[model samples]
Target: MNKYLTLLLLAAVMISCSKPSDIIEQRTFTVSLDTVQVDSKDEILFLNYFLGVSTLDPSQKFLYNLNVRENILEKINLETLSLDTLIQLEREGPNGIGSPFKIIALENGGFVFSNNYTLRYMDANRQVTKQTTLTREPYITDLLPSGKSLSVQSNGISNDGRYLAGLYETSEMSDKPEGIVWFDLENNTGKLIQTQALDFIRENNLTLELEGQIRGGFSTAVFFEPSQDKILFSPTSRNMLMIYDLAADSLITKKYDSKLTSNEQKPGEAKTITDLNEFDKLREDLLKEVTFGEWELDSKTGYRWRFSKELDRTIGEDSLIFKTVVTAIDENFELLGEAQLPQDFVFPYSFWIRDGMPYVFLNIDDELAFVRLKPNFGND
Candidate 1:
């Protein structure tokens, strides 16, 4: 009788080990884009179509690429929208354009974007045609932009393509709110824009809610502006849209949180997951957890875990991007929507945007993508 009981236990253990696996689900999104007819003249739609996210300029569009592997700017096309090994600088001296803050196609055949230290542009030959100096006066994290230290976040080119206008990064830690900065880019033979957010604000005089709860949170995807020329930004954690008008030199702060169905979505449409090593590590960790037993999905937390689970899968650090939806808006800064986020997804690391179109780049650590209006946007 004892042997029979032991044999039955062994049979049960073998059956459990060979049990079919439960489905590990991914967040599915039936996303839409206000897609236009891709210009036949453009050959590299999938190749050179990454729109650099600038708060001010869209026509200031230029083509550039990130080495991605090294977490550095690999090639910037200063000229004919091509690639080169040279580092593009935005400012004085031959500084390398590491962080590709923005990039666009220039009419005369070139591209430009901001690195950590400069506003670099390239000409047709893909050479360092221009480099505007950046004021790295007070270099610290959290972007402490004082008066002397020009903080450039976004910029815009004029309709006639004669001038470039946009927000210059600044902080009036001394004065009122340390508003936005405006600068000139056409003859930008210098480093930073010598404009003020107050100048633009007074022109349009658009009022924005400067102080809000949960000040700075993860960009979760991409924060979008109308064009690179408009210094407009949206709140991922809050419910507001910050628009800095270059002509007005003012920030027209619009609150999306105002009675709208605002969903926290991956900011951009889609981005390439660049880091391979990091992704592999995540897979291994997840597999280890899966080996323990069958996990259950809990909606309240959006996680499949046992009471003994201690691994914290922070989105930007561990998982992918956080996606949401911007459904509708009303009068006040009260947002309304069913926010849909990935299980264990926390936030985003970087951001990107497209030129001309209303698309934004939603970049997680390894995952990256663009967010745009559905092709049939407003159709429904």
Candidate 2:
């Protein structure tokens, strides 16, 4: 009887170890362009550094980007494709913004940005509405007072526009918990909402470069539900989604069963850098030759991760060209779509979902272009 029980256990384990065949319905999105050309008269030299995009209105017809060039915040209208300089930051003064770091778009068409660790909120007119100093609160384990040393990698505003979420990594490079904070924009109070212990580093087989982990690979993208008091997020490295219930203060992880590999190449082709070892190899080779760009994505659609490689054939002296790859996965983490973007395509693309479909915004040389994904195209 014991032998039979052991056999049954072994069979169950084997079945669990087998690859899952079921996947979300595979679909192809048709790509197109709704071009928006920026005029030189606008004084915006380039759309080279993209901060973020926000609709600011429920209509979703208009999009705005708070872009930066040498510390100036320029608001670009996506609907009209017009540029307006709202604020020119200074080094020291009341309105002095000391080297702006990141921008957070609000629901009401306004935005927030960090200048030297101070959170500043701006109105639609690009005027400073409020400012708050980042502080430490006790909700997460081993909570450290981040002060000005907190490195905010990615941030998002809740759909309700009440909470601002900031994902933090300290510059100290010690083995500590990875945490995110939610600040009540109204009350000027914040709490450390989520944290993951470092013990999982071994369990997940995270590759550590030098003394610390490669944070860019594990940075989490925070997204809020349109109507619910919940947040959905995914780490950059793996095919997993985590939902945080704000009201209950509970977390739920959804790991999709997938057979798809994270390869930009077509099926069965040798991947350039499929896993961590290959990634390390690429890093070593490109240590002095390349710098990665931003990772931008839309809700439900996938994301585009980019990099600029310094070419051996110089356009002049040390000229750089960009390359980007777009990847789309469904809620189940199944590969729904992908595209190896053209070299002429722009950096820091924008994505949004309208009417249950995903759309991407790109700047093609002189014209801004939009690409929308369509459904399945004949099973391959």
TM-score per model over all chains = 0.39, 0.56
Q: How would you encode candidate 1's per-residue C-alpha lDDT over 192-311 as one tens digit per residue? A: 224342332211111112233222211111133333455444422333445555555555655333121222221222112234554345334432220111111222222221111113
lDDT, candidate 2, 298-338, per-residue tens: 43334322222222233565565544444445444344444
Q: After superposition, how far is residue 187 of candidate 2 from its true place, in Å?
A: 2.7
lDDT for each of the candidates?
0.33, 0.44
lDDT of 2 at 213: 44
For candidate 1, give the lDDT of residue 288: 24
Residue runs of model 2 more than 4 Å from their true location after superposition: 1-36, 39-42, 50-59, 66-75, 82-92, 96-98, 105-109, 136-151, 154-156, 159-161, 166-180, 188-228, 257-260, 263-380
- Candidate number of the best lDDT: 2
* Model 1 steric clash total: 88
